[model samples]
Every structure is written in C-alpha cells, then in structure tokens.
Target: MKRMTTLWSYLLTLLLAVTVSAAQESSAQSLLRSEAPTSLRADKTLSGFGYADRNETKFNYIGTKKDLGSFLSEYIKLPDVGVNKITKISFPANKADAGNSYIIILSEDGNETLYQQKCSIIEGINEIELTKPFVTESGKRYLVGFATKPLGIDDKDFAVLPFDYGSDIEGTSYYASSIVPYPSEDNDTFTLKSPKGLGSACIFVTLEEETRLQTLAYIINVSGTFDPAETGKDITTRFTVRNIGVTDITSFDLTYQFGTGEVKTIPYSLKTKLKSGKTGYYAFDIPAEGDALGAVHFAVAKVNGETNFFANRCLDLPFRIGDTEANAIPRETVLIERFTAEWCTFCPGADPFVNAAVKSLSDAGLRVSYVGHHLDDPFAQPESSQISSYFQGNGIPAMAINRVPQGQTSLLMHPSNFQAAYWTSKLLAEKRGVRIDKIEQTITGDKLQVVVSGVAFQRTFDPENLYLTVILTEDNVAAIKQVNGGANYKHDALPRLFLTDALGDLLSPAADGSFTMTLEGTLDAKWKREQCKVVAFAHDNLKSSLMSRRNVYTAESTYLGVSLANEPVALGQAPVVSAEDGYLSIVGDVDCFELYDMSGALVTTTVWTRLDPGVYVIRIFSNLRAYTSKVIVR
Candidate 1:
C-alpha cells in the first residue's frame, strides 16, 4: 500500500511539471505576433504573397537556389479556427519537388518542431487538403513552412517557388536552419531567424487587409526649407497631408521628432472632408529644438482614433533652424545613379531623360556625377545588383541622386524631368558644408587602393553622426542587347565594386570636422580593370545627409559636362520645352520622339494635344542624348 501511494504521487507531480512547462513555453511564443493581422483571418488563404503574381504558379525560391533537404519558411500568425477545422496548408512548388516535401509547423520561438505532415507533396496550391488538421490558436504566431527531401546525390530536391521578401507583405519570411533528424519529423528542435535585408524567401501569406476596423494611412511626404532661427524658439512650419484611404476623414495627428529625442504630436482638425487621393497643407507652429548646424526632424501622420500603419512610414528630415553662418560651402559633387536594366522596357525612354537631366545640370558647369547602374541583366555583374538592392526599390528606372537617398529624384518618382530634377537636387544638396580633396586611386595588380580626405565646414562629422561609402563604376561596358529591342545599346557607368558596404561603412567621425579614410578592394577578373573608376562620398549618418562634395575617380568625364554646348538648345526654331494653356508643347532636334504612359507602354501623341489632367513623362531626344521631363498636362 505504501509503495502504491508513492508511485501515484510521483506520477501526478510529473504530469503537473509537464503542464506548467508547456504553459510557460506557450506564453514565451505568443510574443512573435505580426503587427498587422491581414494574414490571420479564416477562409482566407495565406499563400505566396497577397499579390496574385506571387502564388504557387510562380517559382522564386528564398534560400540557396533550389537545394532540397533545405528549409524555406515564413513566420505566420494563424487565426483561430474551430475544433481542428483549419485543415489546409498550401504553398507553390517548383515542379521538381512535386511529391516529396515535409510540411512543418514550428513553435513560435522556433526552438521546437511541433508537428510535421510527411510526404505532403503540394500537388497544386490548395490541392492537398488536410484530413486530420493540426489545430491553431488565435493571436499565436507560428512557423508554417516546408523542407524538401534530400535526393540521393544524383537528384536535385529543391526547385523554384513563390517568394517575395519586399513590398507590402514584409513580415512574412523567417529563416529556419536544417530541421533536426533531417528526414524525420520526430526530432523536436530547430532555430528560426529573420531574413537579411528585406529577406529572400520567395514566400507570401494570404490575409485580409482588414482584420477588424483597420484602415491604412500614409504620410506621403513633407517638403520645405526651414528659416533662420535660434534653438528653443518657436517656428511655424507647414507640411502637406494626403488622405490615401477610401473613406474621407476629418481629423489627423502629425508627429515629428526633435533632435533632442523628444517626439511631439500635433492635431489637425479639418472643417471639410479631406477626400481620398486629395492633398492639403497643414502646419505645426511649435518651438524649435536643437542647435544652429541643424536638428534632424522625423515626421509621421496618423488618422484620429485609429492605430493605422502611417506611423511606421515616418519621414526623417534634418534641417537647420538658423542661417548658414557655420557652413560656408555646398555639396561639391552630386552623383546621379539610375538603377536601370536592359530588361526594363521603360528604361530606353527613361535613359534619355536621365542622361538629359545630367546634361542639363552639368551644362550649368556644376560638378555633377552620373552612373548608370545596369542591373537585372547580363551586362551588369552581381555587385551592380547589390548596389541596386541596397536602395531596396520595387521598380526600375530608380535613381539615387547623391549617394544618400534623400531629396526629390529618388526611385519613388518617375524619371520625367532628369535635367531639371538633377539640377534642383544638386542645388539643394550643394548647400551642405563639406569638402573632399586629394582623391587618388592606385590600381596595383588586382589590388586597388583609394585614399581620400574630408573636412566638414559647419559641423562635426563625429562617429555618432557620420559614415563613409565608396563605390567603383566603369564606363562603356559594351551593351549586348536592349530592352526596347534595339541592338544599338551602349551600357555606361556600371558599378563594378562597392569598396565599402553596398550601402555604407562606419568611420571615426571627425572631432574638428575633418577626417581621412583608406579603402582596399580586389578587382574581379571579369571586370575591365583599366576602365574602372573609384567613387567615394562622405555622409552624415545621424542626419542622413550626403555631403555635397565627394571623392570620385577624376580621370574622365564621359559627358564632359559639355555635351549640351555643341548642339543648339533648340530644334531649328522650337524651344526645348514650353507649356501654354492646357497643352504642353515640346520639340527638339531628333529623328523621333516618343511618349509613354505611366505603365511604360508606348502611347501615340501629337506633341500638343487636349488631354486629360494627369502626369506624363515626355522624352525628347537628339543625336547626342535624350532629354526627359515630367509634364503635368492640366
């Protein structure tokens, strides 16, 4: 009797310990929730991305090409489905892994492997329905993923499938290590990781955009130059607001952060409904904070009474509140980099405009730089792709004017008025106080050395505030083909190496506004050694400012900043561009000019036409190069 009682007590204690441990683990895991519930709703599929193009039909793998026995995963917050009714788990399969994949469910912490669907070949998306489904709880994030079975040395187990780590569905991809007990689900341990950059698993989850009563608001952009004033003094600054949602609203909350790390929110109550797609100007009359060199400002917009997504899309702006007394010079050289590809159909037209913009700006005799980043094609190497990816653009014809992605001509906007755009951006960036001197590059054998120095005139380039970035680009790579189907294409200013990081590098910020740095790199055999040029720039890490002047390879100016002078500014008698009334009249000396719709499709136009009110990119070309502009035909 004594022995029986002792055994029973031991069993009960063991059961209680397991229950408590499970509860603790569950609590720890629930922390992995997504900020948005769009993908956790019932009856809605979370496959590929929310975009139709990213469904199972498309195949772009996330991990190393298509290696089987490897893991491809996404962190998903599974919604509550009643009594084990959430039966289906589906994902696109690259034809190779048609019948040999293990569907898996991992714990939130990704420390334990909970369940596995063995031989769960995703025949088609939603084709393999679960007979006895694994139950999921609401508000709990889980890893819903798949791992391919390793083939017997001779076979390839991995194949292409849908994956998108960028765009609206950003929180989806999570990296997972090799599942323990490789071919078996019996092993209960694995690690979950966040993908690098926007990440690379070609995966998406289907979720409703609205979980309950959620509406998204975006703080489109804030643009204005601050006036000369002292810190601690109140200055009235106005910003433009846009209603991006379908429903009109009456009130909005604007938040801007001060240099002192204080965040201030201003409320704007409107008398009239600010309809969707409409923009209105709003102001915040508040006292300025921080010193004369300038205080970096971050601004965000949110709808009243709603926790919308606008808060995440805030803008960081560094502007001086007072006169330019401390700073004496502007940014010396502005680099205009256009992220383009031969596969981009819109690039042909965009190239002319971009080059023309450079031409127009350089015509003023300003020290402007241009690099055409040929990407997504054979003409450009992987380093060029890295430079393109650093900016994280979703579309082509992306331009990073001045190494720092600030100012007007960024990838977000169309390449319409390259000339005016570059010039305007140059003027704005040139006002900064920094100078680069004694820039020299020595290429010995396969090793290259770049030595340069910088001096900040107005403020300090301290480690807390600044970093350095170096890039190498080559001219005349000799284009093999073109996206517009033209054989006569010449690729120029292609990036061969990022001497520093693709984005930037950490440097000891100068105490007295002066600094020097040395960078070394190995030349790739495939790269044209003699044609390469070094491009270096100084940047303010804290304020996100690109010093107006940079140290660049000074050997050759392809455009010579003098291309426009040889040709007449007019086509026989017509002005380069002019607008009167509702019609925009554009004419130039060229064989032919083309107009394109925003979609990049070619459209027929008659130079001057009575058209609908909208934005348009007009490309006027001459034998030397093309001039582009965004004309608002109102």
Candidate 2:
C-alpha cells in the first residue's frame, strides 16, 4: 500500500511540472504585427487580390504591366530580443481555391533572398508552421511576401496575400517580377513597381520570444540636407528612434556608415526616459565629403545597455546635395486639369465647384489656370485622349491638381474635392526645387517657337527623369452641343495641340541648374491666334513613384503673342460674366463686352435675332484680369 501511494505521488508531481513549463512558454510568446496592414486594408471592402484567366501559361497580374509575373510583398518589423524565432505565418485565402503558397523573405534592397518556404494552402485563413524557423538580425528590414502557383489540374486560381516591410513607410505596396522565387534579377523585362489602387497583402508572421530583458529601440527615420556647401564638413544627420519594447528606455548605442564605408559607433544617453511605443529624436553628423550619390545606413545597436534587444536600422537612399547657387523655386501657379464630356449630364454638376475653386484660389493672391480635357466631345482632340489615358481614371467631371495624385492610386478625383487638393498640392510644390522662371514665345511666319527656361535645382546629380511639357490650349471654342450646359456651350482651355509628346520632352539641366528647351510647331489655321495660350511645366516621370503620385514641380503659362520682355500684369478679382438664355450679363468694374461667333466674326449688335441656336463667345475686356475670360452663350 505504501509503494502504491509513493508511485502515484511521483506521477502527479511530474504532470504538474510539465504543465508549469507549458504555461511559461505560452507567456513568453507574443504576437508581433507589421504596420503594412493599416495602409493595405485602408479599404475595408477589399478582401483579397487575384485573377482567373483562361490562358494558364500566360501569367496575369495587375498594376502597370500586362505580361510580367508579379510578386507582391509586404514589410515586417520585429522587436529586439536575443532569442527571436519566427515560428509560423498566416494569410487570408479564398476557400474556393487551393494551391502551393510561398513565403518569401528578401533583403532591404530587394536584390537578394534571405529565406523562402513553400507550403500547401487550404481554404479561408491558412496558418502554416515553418518546418525550419529563421532568426532575424537587429537593425535590418525584411520584405515578407506570399506567392502561389497551381498545384494540380483542379486548382484553377492562385493568390496569396501581400506582404510589405513598409520600407520608408510611404504608404506604398510593392510588386517585383525580377526578384527570386519568380524570375532572375537580370530579367530587365520586369521592373519593380508599386501598383495603384491595390493595397497591402495582409500577411501575419508569428514570433516566439525568449528573454526577460526589456527596453528596445528602433531607428524610424534618417534625414539630412544634401547641400554642397556642407562638403568636407560634418553635416547634421537627424535620426528618429522609437522605443518598441515594453519598458521605457534611457539610453542606446547607435552605429552608422556611409556607402559601405567604415562603421562608427556612438553611445547616447537621453535626457528623459523614452516610454514604451514612444519615439525619441536625435541628431548625428556624417562627413559630407564622399561620393555625391551615396546613401547612409544607420542602426540602433544596443538599447538600455543591453545587446540582446532587437531594433530596426534604416538605410537612407541616395540624395542630391545640390551644388547650384540657384535658390529653390517658389510656387507660382497651380495647374488644374478637368476631365469632362459634353455627353455626360452629371459633368455640369462639378462645374460650380471647379469654377468657385479657381476664382477663390486666384483671389487669394495665387495664380491658377484651368484646362479642360473634353473626352468624346465635339471639341475633343487626340492629345486630350493621351493625357486622359495617362491619368487612367474612369468617369467624367474628374479633376487633377498639378497632375499630382490626391490619393494612393489616381491623379483624378471628384470635382467637389478640388479646393482641398489645391492646398495640399500647393504645399508639395513649395518643397520642390524645380521652377519655371519664364516662358518665351515668338511667332515666326506660320510656326510658333517656344523657349522654356527654368532652374531645376539638380547640379551634382543628373535630372534624367525630369521633362518639360508644353501644351497649346485654346479658349472660347464655339459651336458645341452640351448636355447639362444648356443647348450650346463654348469650351474653354481645350487642348488643341501638344507641341511635345503627350508626356513631355526630356530635360537636360546645365551645370549651374539652368535648363532650356525649344519646341516649334506650325499653328493650325482653325485655332484662333488671339485665344490660344502656351503652357509649360517641369515634372518627374518615374514609374515607381507614379504609383502614388506624379510630382509636378512647377508650371507657368503665356499667351501666344506674349514675350519675355512683357511685364507680368498684376490682376485683381475676375469679372463676373455670365451668358445664359441668349442674354449677356457683365458684373465687374471697367469691363466692356464684345461678342464673337464661331467664324471669328465680331458682333456689334444688341439684337437677339443674330444669335442662333449655336455656341457664342462673349469676350469681356477688363484691366483687373491678365487675360479676360470668354463667356458661353446658347
């Protein structure tokens, strides 16, 4: 009886010990999430991304290209701990399809693959355990992505949720066709692009932690001026660190290097404790005497005097320390492009907001120009089609501010948001260094020669992607049949001609940052010489950046007859002129009305009999306007 009691007690004690060990293991494990999902799932309605095509051999992918095999990825960041093990990964999937899904990890540059594993996928959410776990190093970025291929004849569709390391955290999701596990890097046919309208692929990674040590820091941002004046001197490079651990951190060890050069370590003690999930700002100096196209890599090596903690380091991309003496360009004009069609009845609803915004912005001491790209209308031109296609937006009455996108994917937005977009794009333009100082146009015989002179503040580096776009738009185009714009509506700012390519002519800035480009074209006989204006601007046309925004740095306009010698007229409020129901109303001070027909014949009559059921232009002459507007009459 005594032997039996002793054996039972031993078994009970062993069971209790095993249970306690499991409880400790569960307590040590915590979920580490990536911020990519916030931006990816920004649109909650979208569940997942994939495609179903009849042609199995042809790889189908969305965003920017047609033939490339796309690999969409998200970014993941882990906290600092000595024993950090990524045990498993989870992703959302459609229950209808089954295939082989791959979990890929790439280095920060997207050039080399650190690790990748393939797993059989199931319906709904797939939680797959990694057969071999991978450990991550501190102060590094890893791009974790999901890819899939058809496993059998029954599996018709393939897709995995996107993963992004949130590099630079520009709220952008990336797609690469040349990266490994898809195609070789030398396959120049496919380039890295962040497609528009597609959000992040929400891929969750599970990490098991084993350490009692608290307090960790991550380098969030690294920035500094690339000014040539600071050459050979220690320029102050700003660093922003965040305490991502549970406990507050008081100090950390920072290490930095420029372009793979010698690494230098610095220990910093903060004046106040940086609380958990809080950020601290610090500044360090890097010698500015190296190559003009060099990047700085920085890492938080230690936190709170502990080396086992995990922290993310940052790699700052190449920057141009401008060597030109020219000052940064001041924003002068905000170009507003409107997409409209005479057939669209709802397009007229947006006219009030657009007109109001133009007037309001101009009245506030800023120059504004409105260009209407009429689609499928009587006045529609081929050039307008190219511009419209470049914007890649559907629906009519959409507006774009300075050719810059208002959201993550498109340059066009509803007209109701025009005023708000103007202010936002205005602030962005002020930060750009490209400026159009002057636009010179001279008429020689039937050909009009245009010389666009500007200062693009890129001296040490070449501005290869920058281009100069010159557009010829005509105002007061009569004889149009509009839907909601009454029986007859005269279109203004119609893009009649494009002297350069629809995109733009590539610009080459001189050593001093000044650039000049000439575009000459024979004026069309149908276009009215007095009503046409020349529009010129400098813009950046990089494909990767175009996914989110197309940076239109600066813009300016000049009338056909205007020369550089002419002084710019300082104007006041625009004349309130309206043409409705065959009646002309002018409300501004010191303005006279002159009417013209489609044939360019001046009308001196007050009789309404001469005005037929066609479009008419009522030109108002006023000193308050640089160039008075032409009203539309039915």
List all candidate RMSDs to the true structure. Answer: 21.2, 18.3
Worst 10 residues of 2 by lDDT: 46-55
Q: Write the per-residue lDDT of candidate 1 for residues 422-528, one digit (tens) a residue.
A: 45664645465556653556667788777666665644222234556667777667666776747767676777777776556765635676667788888887776
| Cα lDDT tens digits for candidate 2, 21-63 | 2223332221111122222222222111111111111111211
Off by over 4 Å in 2: 1-326, 389-394, 420-432, 458-462, 542-549, 565-634
| After superposition, candidate 1 runs with Cα above 4 Å error | 1-230, 233-289, 292-321, 381-394, 403-413, 421-430, 460-465, 485-488, 540-634
Whole-model Cα lDDT of every candidate shown, in order: 0.49, 0.56
Q: How does candidate 1 score on lDDT?
A: 0.49
Instruction: Give the range of the ten consecutive residues with the poorest summed lDDT in model 1.
Output: 557-566
